[model samples]
Every structure is written in C-alpha cells, then in structure tokens.
Target: MLKTAYTLLPALLGMFLLNGCDSSCCMDVPPASNNGLQAPTPVITLDGQPLQGNLTCDPTTNQTITLTAASSDPDGRVVENIWKVDGVESGSVVVCPAPGESKQICLIAVDNDNLENQTCVTLTANNTQPQEPQATPPLPVLTKGDVDGDGGGLYLQCDNTHDTDSLHLYPEDGPFLYGSNDPKDIKEITYNYTYYKADGTIESGPITTTQTEFNEANDQAPGICKKWFHTNNGVATIKVVMTALDDDRQTNTKTYIYNVADGLLVEQP
Candidate 1:
C-alpha cells in the first residue's frame, strides 16, 4: 500500500505542472490588432461648392463646369488626380461635355495605392447667332465731245459734269497718242481728246486740252488737216484749213471775188 501511494503522488504532481504550463502560455498570448490600417476617404467639390458622388448636366444652356476633389489614405500615401467625361478618362485639362442633351463631367482623386475617390458637375450651352449684309456704290458714265463747245483757241474743254474723277481718253483706233495739261486739277477742269480713223483707229494724240475761262469771241481752231467751206455765192469751197503744225505756226486765209457788177468786195467763195 505505501509503494502504490508514492507512485500515485508523482503522477499527480506531473499532471498539475502540465496544467499550469498550458494555462500560463495560453494566457500570455495577445489578441490580433486592428490599429495600423484604415479605409481611404475621398472628398469632392465643384467650382467652389462641395459636391456629392456623381453629377448630371444640361447641354443647351451651360458653358463651363469645373470639378475638384480631396482624397486621403490613413497610411499617409501619395495620390494623383484623374479627370473624366461621362465614364471615359480625359486629358489634364477637361473639355466641356458633349453628345447627350444632358452632360456629365467627372473628376477623380486617387492615392499611390490606386484607391480612388470621384466627383462630377454639369453644364449647358446655347447655339450661336448670324450676321447682317452690307451695301455698295454706283459706277460713273463716260462721254466724248468738246463739252463746252468753246471754239478752237488756247483752252479746250471736254464736258465731264457727270464724271466722278479726272478724265481719261485714248485714240479710238491705231497709233494712239496721249497727253495731260499743266494744271491737271480735275475739279477746275482739264481735257482729253482722241481722233479716230475711218476704221476706228486712233489718229492724233488724245490731247489733253488746257482749261480757261470761256471766250465766245475767240474762234476755236480745228485740229490738223481739218477743212471748212465758205458758201457766200451758194458755191461751197474750202475756206478754212488748219495746219498740221502747232497753233503758233498755223495760218488763216480768206478770199474775195471782184464782180464787175459790184465795186466793193461783193462776195466770198
């Protein structure tokens, strides 16, 4: 009986020591911690106003819409801002919305971890208007002649009362000659003339006759090779002939007939 009791005592002591070791080891181990990591928070705003999740806009009446956001990670991670129109990502600078009557512009803020927070805004635009028409002025008329009909002398005139600016004349046919007067003031007066051949070819210089006060007494001289007839006796003969040379070198001749029936210069032919 003494031997059995001693053996049982050692066994009981072993059981007690094993129980204490298990209890101490289990009790010393700590529960898992949830302190280090946290969810990211993304904040969004527009122009200057805070915004909710997504946005919808009117196409016809809005011109511009701006969106912005603030996003953060509990781990203090760095992030990039991304922009999108509707669902498609866009360039750095956002463009106004398109396609549908209502447009949606979105902006998203993302962390280095690629976690994202997004917000959007809407805008509407109107159509453009048209412009008006302009008016034009009329053209002037041109005519040929000795406008004032001043007889051949120092000053020659071509009428241009209806002309807007200075006058221009060229010989109608071949061998065209052109000239201008000393005082080329169109308002006060200046003249241009052209002589044409039978075939409508230019003959003499389109001589720009000088301007002067009208003198009815001074007979206008004809140009070169011009002829006139005197008809006192009903017989018409060449009475006046203009020389081809300049006026200073020209000459005039008159003829009188002495009829035996009359003493004085009775008639001129």
Candidate 2:
C-alpha cells in the first residue's frame, strides 16, 4: 500500500506541474500601452503673414487667424490631425473679439497630439489720413517757324515764339512776290527736331512749318529758322528748309547750321 501511494503521489505532482505550465501558456494577453504616441508641432500665422512678422489689420473687424499642425509616427500609423482654437476643438483658426476700436489680437495653434504654440499681434488702422494735393507743373515753352508767305514768292520773316500745348506753325510774316491761286502752288514744309532720351532713344518731330506756294519772281528771303530746345529729353538739333514752285517746277532748298542746340547742327559735321 505504501508503494502504491507513492506512485499515485508522483502522478498527482506531475499533473499539478502540467496544469501550472498550461495556466501560464494560455493566460490572456494584457493590452498594449498607447503612451508612445507623439504629438505634432503647430505653426501659426496672421493675415497671410509669417509669425513675428509685420501684420496689418482693421481695428473694426474680427481678424481671421490661421493655424497648421504637422505630425508623423515611426510605426507608419495613420493618425488624424486635430485643430483647436484657444482650448476647444473648434477647428484650425479663430477670430477673437470681432474687430472694433480694438488694436490688439492673439492667435493660437495645436496639433493632433495636443502639442501647441501661439503668437500675439498688434494692428493700427485708421490712425492717419492722406494729405492734400500741391501746385501743378509749369507749361512748356514752344516756338513755331514759317517757310513761306502769302502771294506766291517767299519773302517774309518774323519771330514765332509762343506758349502752346504742342509744336505749332504760323505765317508770322508773309506775302509772296509772285502769287498763284492754284492749289498746287501751295507746299507743305516740315521742320525737323531730333533729340535723344535717357535710354538712348531717338526722338524727332516736325516741330513747325507752313504750306507751299508758286512764284516766278527774284526774291531772297531768310526762309524759315528753327530753334530746338530740350526740357525733358536730351539735347537736339533743328533743321530748317523751304519749298516753293518756280516756273511750274518743284523748287526746294535747305539752310545749313540755321538752327543749333548746344552748338550742334542737325546734320553731322
């Protein structure tokens, strides 16, 4: 009986050891720790301007503020970024105390993990006004030229200086020696003035002149004279010429060095 009892005890001990092993192997697993999650940093701005930057705002309206949060995890886990204003989950940006006589503003930002950052800004609106207009600029001085006179033969001379909006021509002195009523007797004369711009751009113009005429008489007139001047564009030279009908033939002639600007002639020396 003693031997049998010893053998039964050994079996019972073995069974107890197996049960302990099974209990440990089949135990329920404890839940994983979520404390490893990391929160992202938040970025903040005002009026589309960078933080710590110059920001302008109307003191009479609630200014809209923007906040952006970025986050990532090493486990490639997909996490939704959460936004908060002040302390609540009311989305990304917030407009505090609608604008009105207030010149100060505050903005805050938060990320998915509740990480946060904030900025404060001050704005001054309606503080100063614009000033009034001043006096107008002076008008430009103008001078005209006459290449021919009434009647038909060129024989006249006069000063044609005047203040005008643009270049003008006048028959300051006239009365041709031999006159003709035919329209062909009339000629269109041109006085050219050439100048240069600051950027080396050439500017030329038919500053002034008169119509044509026909004449078959001996006459020696000073013709037309030009005085080129510069106000805005660079210095330039003026060219003067006369045109008339002599015995039904086109007669044209020019004067050299008649008009000069800064001691320079219209034609290159």
Provide the lDDT at 144 for model 1. 20
Give the winner by TM-score. 1
Clashes of 2: 8
TM-score of each: 0.27, 0.21
| Per-model lDDT | 0.37, 0.38
lDDT of 1 by residue, 1-269 (tens): 99999989989998775455554565754431222333356555666567654454434443455556666677756377666765778643344455344445666766665655665665333333223322111111122223233422111122222222232332232221111231121222233344433344444434543323223322323211111112222222111111111111221222322221222222234
Q: TM-score of model 2 relative to the true fold? A: 0.21
lDDT of 2 by residue, 1-269 (tens): 99999989989998775555444664773321224543333334444545564344443455554544433344343245544433445655545343332234433444445443444445434433334333221111123334334521122231221121221122333433222232222223333433444454555554554434222221223333233244334423333343332222334444433232344333233
RMSD in Å for model 2: 22.0
Q: Model 1, residue 105: what's the lDDT?
A: 63
lDDT of 1 at 135: 19
| Runs in model 2 lying further than 4 Å from the true structure | 1-37, 45-57, 72-78, 96-269
Model 1: residues >4 Å from true position, as ranges? 1-36, 52-62, 92-95, 98-100, 119-269
Clashing pairs in 2: 60-99, 61-99, 62-99, 150-175, 150-176, 151-179, 186-212, 187-212
